[model samples]
Target chain A: MESIGIVNYWIVIALMMIALYIVISANNLIKKIIGLNIFQSSVFILYISIGKVGGGTAPILLKEPAVYSNPLPHVLILTAIVVGVATTALGLALIVRIRSAFGTIDDQDVQQDIERN
Target chain B: MIAIELVVNFTLLGFLLVTALYISQTNRLFRAVMLFGIYSLLTASLFVALDAVDVAFTEAAVGTCIATILMLSALSLTGSRKEVRFRRKNATFAVCVSIALGVALAIGIMDMPQFADPNAPANLHVAPYYLQDSYSEIGIPNVVTSVLASYRGYDTLGEVVVIFTAGIGVIALLTARTSKPKED
Candidate 1:
């Protein structure tokens, strides 16, 4: 089934693009950040999904002959998740500071005000 | 040859379109944040469908949990709700970017190997040994762990540095005074 084949990957990519559009198009800073998080997440899924081999077993490397997933993607994804969390935390904290310093979170307003100053 | 894959792909595509519409049309900030969280969750599910347990775990943890929390925190920093308007100039910019991305995607799709074909070069190289002998070679039952910590140790190091730098930057940004909170 062609559906079983490349379609899943395309679906994943579409989700990613939607998230990216939200991020780029959203005027609200927080929403934009939210969009970005979704975007990154979909990418993560894309990478993880690509690592899948049909009927593959886990990457634990059994002594007996067996099918196993590529472990590298799994490990890499673990690191990516950690990095994603760190990035989100940092971004949120920055938003907090931005609110306190600027008294607003709308990007255009921030820009206009800066121009005014 | 491609029936089941087609159905699953279409199903996932439907979800994607619905989510895009929701995010684009939503007026409420809180709702948008919540929808975005749902979006992450679905993406995580996609990872699972892809058979990437480690990546799925991370997506669940980072994308659904941590990222959602951060977005909520950001919401707190901003006003509760307001009129969300998409400016025309911004729309134009988005369209241009979309067109550019479309072209790039077309190029990328052209260059890609046929979907999930076992004979694809990616599946033939390096992967066979890693799958078959990684545990024996590295003495770690978790072949993923072996590959990450042994074969690709330097990659891990780079990740560590990136995270540490981000942490430091966040600390610097959040610091109100010269004082610091001790890390546990």
Candidate 2:
């Protein structure tokens, strides 16, 4: 309804699109993992931006100013980041196994090999 | 002062975009990994600007350190060079889908509250309660930690299990079937 004053969300959205495009378009599996990381990171940025208060400092309680950013999103994202790393590690391990088994890492070649087998 | 914040915000975002573009387009897998590391670092700074110090710390730790090292190890197993190019059809389809999704999300964002509005729905519901009562309830100064480990204990427990399962999965995938090993 009103003109947007904040541009952080839009920037995050753009990053999301870029990450998705990379995931869909990249041929290398490693590149795809990197894209997925970017996608997840953008989502974290979006959440953190939402939690921000106009004049808030970090959520650690101090005597100075009372304003503090939302702690919920930060906590949620902490779990998400740890899970993301675990997932990434698992994905890379799978990739290594694939390369060892097929003797090729290219998606097209791997597919062809599977079909032929 | 506000102008400086705005400038820093945009500049970090600009760097993010540039790094993403390079990562997507780079043919060298090693170079892309390096760029992705930089992207994570930039996002960490952005988190700090948003007063999400805890998120920034985790981002720096997990995104920069763990992800990059895992990727490089994977790269060492696979070849460093990407395939010649993506198929034209796949590239076109990816672009179309990304554009469509981006447009839909941008439109949805139009109704959302402006950045850092204290009265926004997210800030109003649940968050204020956490902030107000966290110290008394949990006897902890760090609201994030109190809420994460105390109020939301189940969620954190689930996360730990998920991480454990992932480690097991990696071990299963990488280990060999045969138990015998040659003497060194």
Candidate 3:
């Protein structure tokens, strides 16, 4: 049981690592953005997982009924998801502007242009 | 319970470590920025597992999301990371110091109350009251909203101020006349 739990933990962590690696190692701008999205989703999963209590039901309060998972985390994650989408929009907007300005999105190419100037 | 928690925590931590390595070794600037965002997000997950909802939310929103976008914008202007050329320089020293500090913190955390132990200080403190009475106290179903809007109202207001200030700064930066040579 203990090992199973540990494996689950590692699996989440491993996904995070894979996403991070893609973000860092990829030369493509789009790939980097994808990695960012993956990373954020991982955190979202973490928040939702922590809030779950064993044998707990959904967090809605019901009269004469019992057992509810904590609603707080769900609420928090909802807000966070909204924020994430907004940020992604802004980020893409910036990327568009960047492409227009530099004519190339690759980091090295832009830097070379700067150096030449 | 402890075993499960430990596995979860370790998994999250392990992912973070690998991501850090990925960032350090990557040769693309845009990719590095994205990785930094990913790193922030993974850390946020760890916070959630620790039952720190507020922290996890902030990390997910500001750190992973907004921060990543800003970084990408900066990357567009700056270009990719320089190709790895020579031997390691100062990296070993930096890594050793950081690792030492991290280990120290982990040791301290080991002494902390077990995750969700009913008798733990955090579980028994004002947190439970907030969890139990948030609905009645504020007439809100979402306990986090009640806590943020009411219990920790002052802090939330401060955050709003910070955001307001940031907006003002952006406006000024964008609207300034005779913007000389700041590339893009």
Number of colliding residue pairs in each model = 10, 0, 7
Best by DockQ: 2
- lDDT per residue, candidate 3, B39-151, as tens digits? 78876777666555555677777767776766666555445345432224434554454455445544544454333333434334554576677778898765666866787
At residue A96, give the lDDT of candidate 2: 82
lDDT tens digits, residue span B1-184, model 2: 5455556767898999999988878877889898988999999999888888888998998889889989988988676565446677888999999999899999989988888788889999999898888888889999999998999999999999999999999999899563332222
lDDT tens string, model 2, A10-103? 9889999999999998877888899999999999989998898876888998866599888989999999999999999999988888877777
Query: What's the fnat for candidate 1, on a 0 to 1 scale?
Result: 0.56
* Superior candidate under DockQ, 2 versus 3: 2
Calculate model 1's interface RMSD in Å. Answer: 5.2
Cα RMSDs, all models: 5.0, 3.6, 7.7
Instruction: Select the stronger candidate by TM-score from 1 and 3.
Output: 1
Clashing pairs in 2: none
lDDT of 2: 0.86
DockQ winner, 1 or 2 = 2
